[model samples]
Target: MTIIATLIVLGVLIFVHELGHFMAARSVGIRVDRFSIGLGPRVWGFRRGDTEYVLSAIPLGGYVKMGGMDDQVMERIEGGAVAEEEDGAAGEGKVQPGRGSADASRTEAVPSAAGRRRDSDFDSKPVWARAWVISAGVIMNMIFAFFAYTAVAAGWGSAQADTTRLGQVVVSFLPEGTEELEGVPEGAHFTRIGDRAVEHWGEVREAILDAPAGPLTFQWDNPRGEITVPMPADAEERRRVVMGLRYWVEPELIFVEPGAPAHRAGVRAGDVVVAVAGERVHLWSQVQDLIRASPGREMEVVVARNGEELSFSVTPSSVDGITPDGEPQTIGQIGVQAQNPPITYTRVAPLEAVQVGWSETVFVTGFILNFLGDLVTGQVSTRNLGSIVTIGEASGQAAAEGLPVFLSFMALFSINLAILNLLPIPILDGGHLVFLGIEAIRGRPVSAEQRMRWSQVGFFILLGIMALALGNDFLRLFGL
Candidate 1:
């Protein structure tokens, strides 16, 4: 299932990216020789007109081959002839087919004008046109991500911003040497903390922040039942009294993986999980633990939706997991996530949805840029880098969760693809843009030998990055 999901996700993203190039080439009158969705030997393909659309064996990346793009190949494509493109030319020229000897002689008598290059050749296009062609792929990916995000937001509705209900309980160590409480489970609602009535998470936060320094009593409604915990008396410990607890907007269904137990049982987004196996729950962690502990066992689930309660019986699925002790273990998984619920949620108008989607895209774009900067500056670890394997695992997990989650993942991947391709490194779209920029400034293209040398360098750099990412994937998967 993970493999399938990964392929689908990657295929869609790669296809959209390549399609952008193909369309731009056609629109700009450049002849595209090949439109491929993968690398390496051709697995399957078909030709249409002048272009061969191929599905290659290596599913890592794809490319669009355009006429006159490769100088060596272009020589053969042009029948051992290279047309001298006239400077400042914009439009395409007509091809005179099947010229007779007499016609050839007559054509030779008329002097060729500057800017009279083949319409279908890549180099014959104006610099701006070429720039657009190189950038089209990134543009398409961004556009695709925006629409996808918009659809997801519109369909699921935005998280209500003013929601005050508790969504999760963050259980952590209270300070050392403090009163050790027992049986304090996560997924509890904060009804009150030290006799301060809590209507919203903000109130809870304020109360915790301003409480007098002393042993404090924390009150919350646990899934099993209502419980109260005595906090540590130490001043520092009292200041951090709410470390193990978190108040959220509302308890809502945030994730449902496709083909997972929850998905199979018809669990969906917007459905508020109220109980697991008849036990009332407030935190997503409680639901996660319950599912994780019940491999292959059917459990009753109750969710609230639109003021109505619905029930489902879900059997947890077996999946590979690692224990805290670094031992391989088979854990039960229902393919759901309850943590990170939105502070507020509500429906949006179509225009609002579009606005939100665009904003999200912009935000993600900035995030990727910042992440890249951090990576280069060593502020972030190389271990954070990932490969196709990582993508596959994540995509598969998201697919199991459900469409909304999967689509959201797809959007993120698309943004990643775009940003990565736009990096100003050799052998990438950004590299080509840099070369073109130099050409525009110098009034001529870089020598083929120079381009070739830089391309090789880029290839080595890319190989190193890929290797590092692969190593990270292996380490992560094996708990090494």
Candidate 2:
């Protein structure tokens, strides 16, 4: 299921990218010979007019082949416009060629039709037009990412930390294992941590962690009312006090396992797990800890349903798993999903979703660029790269976790794909554009030999990256 889902997601991204190029080429009057989704042997395709649309067996990547353009035609087209034609000879009411007028006229007349056809070809288009055509694929990708992110943002409210100043007392999160508090929520806001006016969650956390033996005063606001809660005298006793609780900050759920413990426990879509076993479990780790400690034990589960607290008796199923700390443990599991709280719609307007999406797209692009930069600078190990296998395992893990996570994964993967295709490597849209830019500047097409050599290098580099990514995936899957 995970593999299928991953492939589908990847396929959609690839299609969008290729569609961009196809559309751009058509817009510029360039004939596309073929537009294929996926690579290798053609599984299915049909010729429509002058173009063949195909879906290949291997669903990895895709491409667009243009007519009369060897991908470097942009330079030729732009430079050809400014080319000087030989002077014609003076004749009676007729334009004549220069010194070798007779010979030149004979040569030109022979290939007049062919020359006209070539002049109207893709390479004969203006440099800017050619550049636009080549760049349309990446532009479309960015636009798609923006829309996807916008839809998610508009559908689900955004999550904001409780940093808004409502009064003199600010709410903040109190860290776990603080001797001053009992069980404050992980992201609770507070006014004072043992006599200090706390503004940020980090400040509150630090104060609690560094507290000497004393009662901690936390002024906070709850859905019911605002109140000040005193921490326990023993600092060690109240380490995990979270003060300001935020709910439903993440968006919708994307996956749900059939017949899992959650399925049997009456947990359904759009339900938020407000509390587990009567303890506030805002984060997955908190819920995980409770389940780990109470495997096969029935506990009270409180869910937020349409702004109401609904109760259920949920039993954690026993499962063999490894904790984040790397300890092998048999733990309780419920095949249920918790709703990701949508960002507060009031905080951001519907149109702003586009901005959010664009921001996310830019962020992901920068992240990939940085990663590549790190690879070059030796800041990050190249061996840590990933391939399809790694992506599949990641998808599997997200599916196993729940729906909200899977949605997030899709978002990230979409952004990643969009950014990767923009790299200036031959055979990629970016690579083609790079060559076009050089040709436009050089006033001549790059030699076919030079283009082929650079393309080979780019292909090998891409292959190397894929191999590393696959290796990383295997290592992660087997816990190497």
Candidate 3:
């Protein structure tokens, strides 16, 4: 199921990208020879006017082939324009946009009809037009992402952390030695952190972490008292300090998979898990710890639904899952999802959604660039890189979760594709843009031999990157 979902996502992204080039080419009078949705041999295609649209066998990537894109005729042409018309007399005229090269002398070796080749060739078009044709794919990807994100935001609302009240507060245990845990209560409930009024744990945590070292103020509800504690000034100390304090959250069930233990035991969404195996659980993590420790045991479960507390016997299923650090671990599973209390969502107006969408698109674009910079600086590991396999897994998982999640996943990938294509690498849209920029400045395109050499280098670099990404994917799949 994951594989199929991934393929559908990839296929849609590729089709959208290629469609951009095809539409822009026709609009600008460039003759497109073929528009393929995938690479390798054509599985099926139908000719329409001047272009043949095809579905190729390999679903990895796709391309748009335009008329007169071949190297032979491109090299023979001088000054990047053809003034001669079909009448065989040299006349001053703008190169016709429909064909790649219209001059009979330049395209004689090409087998296309003399009428079709005249003024319709791609190379014959102006440099600006050519650049637009090359950049159309990236533009299309970004537009798709923006619209998709807006629709998801408007339809499902965005997920946000509930931060109105504290769930629980616990002692810090870090650095293998500490004395700060002595004064703190075992389960301190907090209402406010510093001067910030926090309704959600997320807000409180952020406030506390952002506070200047010195002394941090806190207001507790259960104890009905205010306290000021010394806060760590050092970055490492702050990290450990944040980890020492655990926030409280109600383990409210959000999703229950069919045929799973929770569903079989009559558990339903909206049920707040109160106890497991006779042990009261205030936080979701506590529930998880108990369940994982006693996998396969028939345990008594209590959930608060509506105004009544219901009880049931559930035998958890043992499943292979990954830990937070990416290590393989066997864990208990009831096929349920939990969230903190006060899950608030707002139905944003259409215009607001668009604004949010644009902002998100910009964020994703910047994130990709920053990630690439980290990769170059060795701040990030190559193992973090993902290939098609990882994409398939993620997309499939999102699809299984729900429509809104799946759409958001697609939007993210759309942004990624746009940014990646715009990179100034050879064999990409960005590389072609570079050539067009040089042409615009020099008043002529680069020599065919030079372009080909740079393209070859780009191809090898792309191949090496793909190989490394694939290696990472394999390692992850095998749990290495």
Best by lDDT: 3
Residue range 1-480, candidate 1, lDDT tens digits: 999998899899999998998898899897766677876555787877877677866687777766554422122212221112355332222112211111000001111124244567677778788888889999999999999989977987553324334544433434543334334444455567666877556566656666665554556665534444454546556545454444453447666755556787788987989999888986666777677778788899999988999999988866555453335456777767654543443567989899879988998989899778867876556767989887887898789767877887899899999999888876778887898899899998777678767766776788899999999777645433
Please identify model 3 stretches exceeding 4 Å from their true place.
71-117, 162-344
What lDDT score belongs to each candidate, Candidate 1 first?
Answer: 0.67, 0.57, 0.69
Tens-digit lDDT track for model 3 on 341-442? 554445678888888788888888888887777667665667678888779878887898678778878888988888888777766788778877887899
Query: Highest TM-score: which candidate?
Result: 3
lDDT of 2 by residue, 1-480 (tens): 878777867787778877887787778786665676776555777877867677766687776655543322221211111112355333221211221111000001111223354442466667677777767767776777667666666766443433522221113344332323334443444566566766554455556566655454556544212334445455433443433233213312333444555545666666766788889765654665687778788898777778887787877766555443334556776655444433223235877767777777777778777766766766555555778866776788776655545555666776677667668877565776777778789987666667757766766777787877787666544333
Runs with alpha carbons beyond 4 Å of true place in candidate 1: 71-117, 159-346
Q: How many residue pairs clash in each candidate?
A: 15, 43, 20
lDDT of 1: 0.67
Worst 10 residues of 3 by lDDT: 100-109
C-alpha RMSD in Å of predicted model 2 compared with the true structure? 14.1
Candidate 1 local Cα displacement, residue 268, angstroms: 24
Q: How well does model 2 score by local distance difference test?
A: 0.57
lDDT of 3: 0.69
